[model samples]
Target: MTEMNYRTALVTGASSGLGRGLALWFGKKGVKVYAAARRRPQLEALAREARASGANIEPVELDVSEAETTLERIRELDDACGGLDLVVANAGVGGMTDGRNFPWEHAKKVIDVNVTGAVATLSAVLPRMVERNRGHLVGVSSLASCRGLPQNAAYSASKAFLNTFLESLRVDLHGTQVRVTCIKPGFVKTEMTANIQHMMPFLLEAEPAVEFMARAIVRGEDEYGFPWPMDRAVGLAKFVPNVLFDAVASKVVL
Candidate 1:
């Protein structure tokens, strides 16, 4: 878990939002970054900006939900890079619906991308890391994982799965050079939340959020929950009675 220079980092969902933020931030630190997203144009623009800043950035078109395609791309990147030092399984989606009324298809898609996709990415990269015995894996969870939210039931549950999965991996990797960290962040101003009609408490801009996440990865922290206020809020939400939480959360509008 000692500080090591990461030569190459792979970031999924890099077309925009937190993934884009992380790619740009890591590039600034002189790491070679493989930015992946479904849109080639946006990914190319990101690559252009990062390259202008002197970071080795390669944009790859990817849809993490598409297991086969994503796995193939990872293999190609691993072969191209010689090795991958970091993998950020950051692709995710959010849908608003009460648990009972939520569309089954949408719920399934959330689990597919947030849960299965995350596992698939790790599976594709971990063997190589295990062989080399050196690498960092970061899964982007959310403060919503701290407690169940009424409207975003599937989204919250998906993140909760990630939180637990990463924590277990952290323990499993004990004594090995490989590191795992789960990041839980409050609302951030990104494409993901931009359309939401809810008030976001202690929301942070994407840049600072990315910087914090990257620092946590560099420090090899086991878990990171951002914006002190949001951390405290989530902490309290965990202990608060469900009745009170439901009532309070029902009124929120971003």
Candidate 2:
């Protein structure tokens, strides 16, 4: 993988899954990483592993769902570090929602972590990065955003919201040294997706998935969705007639 120009990074949800992988990847590249997650023990373990490998990683105990705390903690880190060159809002939650009798609490949790949390993460550092005229901001969206999936109303909608938000952010920051990237990934094996019993198309292991995302961020792509086959499949789904799409999507077991 090509080395990232960023010297310091902050990755939310860094205790496990793609977040953990990305943090390790960045640390291996000699970037000072602030790995944030609500799980203190996991974060500490990750830090130990990274450090043993000669990587500079600091564990940050953070719960992104609490907006105020998230902002305060991230701000403190940014201040302490002088500034963070890259900030990835990788924190997210996923679950199936029942539409028959809407699961408001479940939906709320999904939106809270996946949508609001991501926005809060980016909002915390955006101004400082703009003032310094350099930094990269990235969000982990999903291919589910291409079209709503069965029993995944909240999760899909949350990612859809993120996709548009990142797109607008990218356009608004155009011509500036600050860059925004939205990465829509297909199913990647992780704790979040471990309960999924359906056959996931083009499923990628977390390590390779993180590698793909890291490359995209380093290249500063405005938006990237993969793996290619799954991305193309979802892109084509966008062109399907609504009624037909709904019929097929509604039957999906995931």
Candidate 3:
């Protein structure tokens, strides 16, 4: 774990859900936070709230799915902050349909926003961090990344990519001051999961979940999986036979 105060942090998808929570928390910690999301009104409201708390929070309009726009915005944010100390690629979408039944456009959209966006964000900052030899990168994965699940194949696979990518990044940055952490949370009560119709195990509210994630980032953990029960569940799932896993997962609602 690295022990240095971060003066600036950038969080994507910060208009709502876990991103918003992280932005608020970081701002409260007196870190200059650049909060980005596509929706202007929502982001503006978030900025207002953060300002009310006497924290430096800059709201930026960004759609992670748009690579050029996102990259440009990253450059702008970097210039504004002089240098970024923390980067949290937290923008993602959940697809409700099975892979076969899923619309191809939806799959593309999910991957574009979740996997490619994360890579782009990392690419924008990694070089600078390497040169400075200091910073932390946090990618928000999910428990679904640990194994294939039913109904949400796109979402699950996207997270799996993040898990592997972040792990590889951590390895690449080994011995350097740069730290990469993959946060795999179980079912969290956020707008994204509000319409989900399945039984969610070890469900946690957004605030607590964000707090846990922030602590993990600050500690420079290699990986952070939440809710002891779900962590064990995922661990066991990894050992289960594929046939059995498929059979069991078939019954789970997305």
Candidate 1 local distance difference test against the native: 0.86
lDDT of each: 0.86, 0.92, 0.87
lDDT of 3 by residue, 1-254 (tens): 43238999999989899999999998998899999888889999999998899988898888998897788889788877888999999988986657667688888899999999988887787888899998888999998888777777788899999999998989898999988989998989999999877788789999899889888988888998998799888988899998888888887655
Cα lDDT of model 2 by residue, 99-137, tens digit = 877889989999999988999999898999999999989
- Model 3 earns a TM-score of 0.96
Query: Model 1, residue 178: what's the lDDT?
Result: 90
**What TM-scores do the predictions have?**
0.93, 0.97, 0.96
Which residue segments of model 1 deviate by more than 4 Å? 1-4, 243-254
Instruction: Highest lDDT: give the candidate number.
Output: 2
Quote the positional error of residue 2 for candidate 1 in Å: 7.6
lDDT of 1 by residue, 1-254 (tens): 43248888899989999999999888888788899888999999998888788877889888889898778889889999999999999999997757556688888899989998887787687888988999999999999898878777789899999998888888888998999989898889999998887678888999888889888888988899989888887888799988887888777542
**Model 2: how large is the Cα RMSD against the reference?**
1.3
lDDT for model 3: 0.87
Q: Any runs in candidate 2 off by more than 4 Å, and if so which?
A: 1-4
